[model samples]
Target: MYGPIADTIRTQRLVLEPLEVHHAEEMAPVLDDPRLHRYIGGEPLTLDELRARYAHLAAGPAPFHQEYWLNWIVRRVRDGQAVGYVQATVTPAAPEFTVASASAGATVTPGPPRLVASVAWVIGMPYQGFGFATEAARALLDRLAAHGLRDVVATVHPDNRASATVASRIGLRPTGETRDGETVWRLPRRAAPT
Candidate 1:
């Protein structure tokens, strides 16, 4: 019932504001380029469709999954232009503690699960190669770590070299594991300051 929520995260050149339905308008143009979807294999969504999608993302995950859906709109601090977004889906990795009944010492109840997060970022075509994605992703991860959700992973298409480089720059290395047709990269437990 308890989990991490998205916060407005700021970096040296960008600010990651928690995603809202209103962000769809600005995000539409940023995501309009077809080249951006070359690897992902999807065309850009219309503004209206983006609005609906944003609405869904803002609502967080369904109750049954016990997940924390944290999404943020990445924008430039200089001009407040929305460039893209970053997101993390957090779920319990393991139980953090256990409580034993006072009268029945043998009865043990597990406390909350130690959360693990899967992170991802998208920087619009125009924003690509500007280091915004890297900076924004670092900020996201740092915030998660501060809240004890340092176990992070990212899935990248094996053919997307740029994204792979960004993942490595953020201290994640591929474990040669594939999930849902994407490569899984994990971060070290003790993340080094980058």
Candidate 2:
């Protein structure tokens, strides 16, 4: 129906729009705060750099790549202010069998591939204390779920309590796992409510 899944995700106060290179102009200043990068590492990207990065992100992965890169610009509903962005890199975890093959000796064939995603979100320094990140992350995860992606995870820096709290608020629990030094949080696949 819609052009992309992100186009259909919105919360009470925020709307997720498909990321565009033109968004870099407004987002660059919002993301320019050095403090915001404390946990994520690296300083702010320049306008030019952000534009280039956004352009590349708008272009999907190379052909034959197994990952689906979904990105969106998080905007405030009231004023359409670009607060930050949310992204998920989804890849097939494993194939699930849909039907039994020949019971005698034939190998059972699997059905569609199941998807797993690693998600991330960022809100500007000016908007950090207002719970926008939590709202946006929830919307992202909800869209992921609606898209049939049940295995979702987020990596938060150990020292970034703010991010860890957001992850927790979104039903993700620390998995006791670390990747690239950041703690991994996961929301196990649960049966959907009837």
Q: What's the TM for model 1? A: 0.85
Q: Per-residue CA lDDT of candidate 2, range 1-194, in tens? A: 12466574789999888888999999999999999999999999999999999999888787688888889999999998999999999888877765555758667677766778899999999899899999999999888888777899999999999999999999999998999999999997786589
Q: How accurate is candidate 2 locally (lDDT)?
A: 0.89
**What's the distance in Å from true for residue 154, model 1?**
0.5
Worst 10 residues of 2 by lDDT: 1-10
lDDT for each residue of candidate 1 in 23-116, tens digit (9 for 90 to 100): 9989999999999997767899999999999999988778888788899999999999999999999887877566566764666677755678
Kindly report which residue stretches of model 1 are placed more than 4 angstroms away from their true locations once superposed: 1-5, 94-112, 190-194
Error of 1 at 161 (Å): 0.8
- Error at 142, model 1, angstroms: 0.1
Clash counts for all predictions: 0, 0
